[model samples]
Target: MKDLTSAVEHRQEHRFARSRDPRSAAKILVYHPEPEDYVVGIRRALPDAEVVFGSDPDFLRQHIGDTEIILAPRFPVEALQDAQRLKWIQSTNSGVDFLVPVRERLKNTLVTNARGVHGEVMADYVLGTVTMLHWDFPDLLRQQAAQQWKPKFVDPLSGKTIGIVGLGAIGAEIARRAKSAGMTVLGMRRGSARLGEPVDQYYTREEFDEFLSRSDFVVLVVPATTETYKLVGAKELSAMKRSGYLINISRGSVVDELALIRAIGDGQIAGAALDVFEVEPLPPTNPLWTMPNVIVTSHIAGNPTEYPRRILEIFFENARRYLAGEDLINVVNLARGY
Candidate 1:
């Protein structure tokens, strides 16, 4: 990986060195290729902006010098410094971990995320999964597979308590949907400050255990950050009700894999619905796959059929805000890592 990165960087350096005109709006730098509708939406949003698409390190280094802003699916961390004119970065991913490399270097550049764009889609996923579990859909499937027609009692989502670990756009969306389902929504944020939303109450990190103890379902939507690393572990998992379920849509590392495995094995929580994992592709040897109570997905929570177009909408909205000298929406707080 190191050798491949070095090679890419070397190519980028050559692109930067060979380019004669470092300033051209027609070549506004974009990192990915063939995002037809996304590109169109961006163009429509910034009519005068020029768009350039390249993933090659060399091409990026050379062409980024004159780029005013980057509408990237993935930020070119190593090549960001090459773009002397870069004023802002619109990331396709909600998490801003990719920006860690340039956050300090590009102090003057604004960083925004596709926070709200993917919220509804992800919320739908969570809502659907929660409903299936509540209605004993899994057991029904099992009975059908076994050639038996056993009936089971089920409960409604109404009056159940849902704990939202993060209150960002996605979390807020989940909270709204869960509440509308008649579940009492309890939010656990880093602070106690109230956000304009439908949360019944909010708790701080200090109250995480207390919050977990009372929830029927605990959903994690926090970002990946040093502070959030292993936020949910043995002790936290132990606090949950034995009849409750845990749902994770956030980065995988937020929950400790070993602890989670133990929790489920010991029936600490009823089940789990995991989108992300500590390791990608969830290595063949991982036990979580075979765990009867755990439902695993290959990190598809935020991926929607219209993902690219929705992201472009946010880009256009932010572009309008940026040019108008207004506060951009979904701006990331580097200190908090959201």
Candidate 2:
């Protein structure tokens, strides 16, 4: 009889061995708006490696040729044409849509993301927004502005159903918090019927409509991918409960912005809390900015005071694995677009 677990371990070992040769000496490029102590941490972790620090396109272009590794939130995809020796890229951001522009060029490059780091803060944002909508925070704000003394009935979060569209790290954290608040947590993910802690029920993509119908709040946390592009369209929006609120902490492309505007205008759903947009800066002329039922944030959900430190922890650990010829954490499957 074959030992399945040992066989799986051996297969993984062989796969990583074929991926990259163990090399302590490599050129690393650090390009981020707020790297903080990342360069220092990377230096300590990979003492033999040469580190180049720059945020300007010209400086990055000048050093791209010799860069074996890159640590950044975003990089110019077009400039990657000059990076002849690039082997791996570690994105400080969890979503890697920034790499989509040059997906073909990254076929051979190993890519990892800062995934688990943002969950806590992002979950807090979702909870806060959900509570605001449920408790009618907007009405109170308007009353304060007009010096009115009206008291509106608020809905309790207890026993309310929250359907999280993606059961990744961020979604799991949200489920944890929602469950702690006595809310019924439902989760939708790619596959598997198994229910984990925090989530009481699990649904696959096939059962998305049923999930939407059951939820009092629908949260989208899926990554931006071809399969997920506009995953929440008019049809999906119309399936939700009339009083259901939508919260998007994921990529803007994951939901149809135009469809969302229509849904809100037509009262297909109660309202939405959006942290990301299809066109960011979201344009001053965009209707969402002035919508009474909607709450728009400039995509700062994952940005806490400790965000840089958290991201650096992932990067530093991955650097150790890269030099030790071990499989890296959060290695993105380019084909899967996660």
Candidate 3:
């Protein structure tokens, strides 16, 4: 019988023998309670690569010895030091600030993120919240409680404009949905002057104030990076139209929670829908919980039951590219911090 393992070994033998550096098999460790199919699919995509399953942090510590790549939702900053063999890390989530310290220390390790997967779910969440606000659901709830049939005026989605702070996957999807609902859509990002499909206009960071001034609703979908931290704080908040509403489906730290409180308290903006906060499990005493004009959720905007399957698809695609020595997709640019 022919040796299948030797066939794979022969294909890599010349590359191994000629290189001054040792050519070891690529080994990946996945950290998260991910679907088994995710790991299995990636392994199938790169048959020669060694894939290990480690759902717990303790298992991660023990298995870091041979890990050349890590598929993680989040991991301890200390893991960067111990995982000396780690050459890359693929985060299942968009925000990576929690991994910044580790990223800084592991200068050579490449980092990729799942940027496109969560867009649809997040867009749907934003649209739902915005629609609820436009229809005055809160006011209607009060009237129901009081047993009153008071008629009130509500804003129409057709004539209004929505400004998206980031034109990435999530922002683009939001634009598409908002436009289909007859709202004018605008977006602002650090680069790219042109908007795709549904966006009527695109602005650079310098044009943020202009975008804010004209928007009746502003949606934030940017990731939490050095450049985006507190990007929508006091000054930005003050730039918007007083009757304008704000929606944050991005990370909490992207907006200054204190600044937002002051802005809303002073009636700087009409209302806000926040899905993420600076602190996880926001303390019961947090003022945001009591604010009448605010809608707060526990960071569930981008979550969907299909999340694991979507994440696995990206991993498998990248894993196949890795085997072919192709440049990986969605590779994070450390300097730009996306």
Give each model's whole-structure lDDT: 0.77, 0.83, 0.78
Clashes of 2: 0
Give the per-residue Cα lDDT of candidate 3 at 159: 88
lDDT of 2 by residue, 102-210 (tens): 7788766788898888889999999999999997787779889999998567667996999998888888899999999999999998876445658888988888899
Q: Which 10 consecutive positions of candidate 2 have the poorest summed lDDT?
A: 1-10
Candidate 2, pairs of clashing residues: none
Provide TM-scores for the models. Answer: 0.85, 0.89, 0.85
Q: Candidate 2: give its CA RMSD in angstroms.
A: 5.4
Worst 10 residues of 1 by lDDT: 1-10
| RMSD vs true structure, all candidates | 7.5, 5.4, 4.6
Total backbone collisions for each predicted model: 5, 0, 0
State which candidate has the highest TM-score.
Answer: 2
What local lDDT score does residue 75 receive in model 2, on the 0 to 100 scale? 80
Candidate 1 local lDDT, 111-166, one digit each (tens): 78888777888999899888866665666778889999776766668968999999
Q: After superposing candidate 3, which stretches have Cα over 4 Å from the reference?
A: 1-26, 33-56, 145-147
Please give the lDDT score for candidate 2: 0.83
